[model samples]
Target: MNQPLPQRNEPFRPGETALLLVDMQRIWLEPGADPSHPERGPDHYFYRHTAAETIPNQERLLKAARANGVEVLHTIIQSLTEDGRDRSLDHKLTPIHIPPSQPEGLPVTSLAPAGDEIMLPKTSSGVFNSTNIDYVLKNLGIRYLIVVGIMTDQCVDMAVRDAADRGYLVTCVSDACASATQERHDTALNAFGGYCWVADTDTVIARIEALGKSA
Candidate 1:
């Protein structure tokens, strides 16, 4: 008989866990923030979904994380060089370039980083590959990551999978994330479901509260 793998069911610990917001920049989340976003129109499903669901859930998660003393981190898709030389090959090929000082580089105001919160600027979809996020997380003694953000099928997916592969316990907040389409978001979650624990905003916040009580 094959031996069963050990299951992990411990609640999140405040000092050992972090909430990572991936690519929640204005260009992607806010309508009319980027020129192409305006072309997509204000009523586009992506914009509607974000405004109606993702951002609201993210606010809840942030509140819970902050109150529970879990570290919060943000990532933005940005280029280190003005000429777009520092971007990853994939970003270059996709022509995804957000200049460092562009207004689009800022996070949406509602869920913006608070005092002393860390923000990582990356030129690649996978923050682990592009930034010193691993080192920073390790330095902070973080073992578990709660991930929420934009482009569920891209950067968020990469963060979840990469963080799991690097031996971090990862939880993906489904309602706190979105993609260009609902189908893409659901498909990406299904594909990456094996890599991390999947939970909704309410469930995650409850877990945080439970941990706080325990602490």
Candidate 2:
């Protein structure tokens, strides 16, 4: 089995790293019609739910990342239109049911880029796949990526692999991520361990806080 890259015990370089939050929308959180299986109706079969089950912990990480002045970027996997022409094959296989136009204050809403937070609209698995994320990161001179959010095995795994391939230092906050099943979550984390640093929420937060104290 591939092991995760070795992580230094110290905090990441705050000035050159950012926290990427992926797919935390309400549609994924609440019980609703499964876009992947619309024929099953809203109440049929087991539903794939978000880690919002662990929202408090996720929120803690977000708060810590923000307080440390790390750039915060939010990503939502929604198509530009209903037809989803912009979506990749992976998206077509497991579709998300977002409306043609995402209203303001909607769950998974895009962040305003003016606040040093870039909102990346991705129609695919990895954030780097069809977005300007690479350019933005390069422009900001960022070399490390601290990733958090839902579906540990899917989107998160994709991001970690792609980031590593691009030669960026990557880390996954284990406790801050979730999946439909513990097995799925473990599988992704183990796979990611081969390509990125994996740390629990507390460890990651402590490192970030220490950075604040030293600075």
Candidate 3:
């Protein structure tokens, strides 16, 4: 019989943990926001799943994080330069440009950044690669991260792996993330499942709520 790997199932400490929302912008969440991708309409799998599962779960996670005093940070895809000359080479090659003033680049209204919440704008798929997020997280004393967001196979995957590489304990809220298809979402999670703890929204919320009672 094989022995199980030791787990880092430490309870979340409010002050040392943060909830990271990655690229949950209007461009991705609202089908109308990016007319360039007309195929992704209201009934598309991504949108349907996001509306049915991701957003609602994220709302629950956000509520619990806020109520329990956990740090909340949001990341959006936007260029620092109006002409997008500042975007990473990969972004330019992929033709992913969100002008500094683009409305679609802003966070979706439903899960918008609340008062005093930090918002980091990046042009790369990985927030840590394009923004000063590592420094900021270190400075804020954030040791553990609870991540939820769009394009689970891309930005969410990068965030999870990169954060783990940088030595921050990571928990990915699987239900709170969406990809273009269910297959993509599940595949991405399994691909990087080794990097972080994979958890559902309900489990994460219960943990956050328990933090309050533990105090």
Candidate 4:
């Protein structure tokens, strides 16, 4: 059996951990010309504010993770094909309009991974459910994950639960994540506090910088 994860402080063994960027793709981050889900509406005020707070933090966080030798991984939602068959009810019916359907080249709004950084294109909220991310993480000896992304209430929450269950120490960077609205964001963060330790981007960044300096 695999070994258990470390307590918060005891983890972070150089190359043995990673920073995961979840669903920061343009379709999710920026409002499209045509709203995908008419019900959800073209990204509202809450989304704009959330993005304002999250995007910068993630950009800084990713920078620190890279300089410190922590593996940087990104996840983007993309359909395997244009056929609506592979998508869920919401995705099938709601058409995406921004850069429409295809995943755009990153470095979007100060957040983009280096060519060496791995990009896991997924179709589900739980990154593990749709990709070989778990296998890749395990191969890299990554027993802990620092997660930062868009929509803290949905994709981030689902990924955290899955990661913890799979025996990886999960750290949810609160400020580096956002929801469509503050209410939803706070709800998910506070509700799942027990499942994972939620942290701030500044604190995480300092820790990474300090550790990198010492090493």
Best by TM-score: 3
lDDT computed for candidate 3 = 0.90
Write model 1 residue lDDT over 1-215, tens digit each, in one string: 99975343357876898999998888887777765555787898999999999999999899988988899999999998888899989888977899887976889898899999999999988999999999999999998899999899999999999999998999999999999999999999999999999999998999888868978
Instruction: Output the lDDT of residue 92, model 3.
Output: 88
Error of 2 at 57 (Å): 2.0
Ranked by TM-score, the better of candidates 2 and 4 is 4
Q: After superposition, how far is residue 210 of candidate 1 from its true place, in Å?
A: 1.7
As a whole number from 0 to 100, the lDDT of residue 199 in candidate 3 is 89
lDDT by residue (57-119, candidate 4, tens digit) is 888898888889889999877666655456555554554322225555243656777868898
Q: Candidate 2's error at 208, in angstroms?
A: 1.0
TM-score of every candidate relative to the true structure: 0.93, 0.80, 0.94, 0.85
Give the higher-lDDT candidate: 1 or 4.
Answer: 1
Q: How many residue pairs of model 4 clash at the backbone?
A: 0
Residue-pair clash count for candidate 3? 0
Worst 10-residue lDDT window, candidate 3? 5-14
Q: Candidate 1 has what TM-score?
A: 0.93
Ranking by TM-score: 3, 1, 4, 2
**Worst 10-residue lDDT window, candidate 4:** 96-105
Off by over 4 Å in 3: 1-6
Q: What is the lDDT of residue 111 in candidate 4?
A: 72
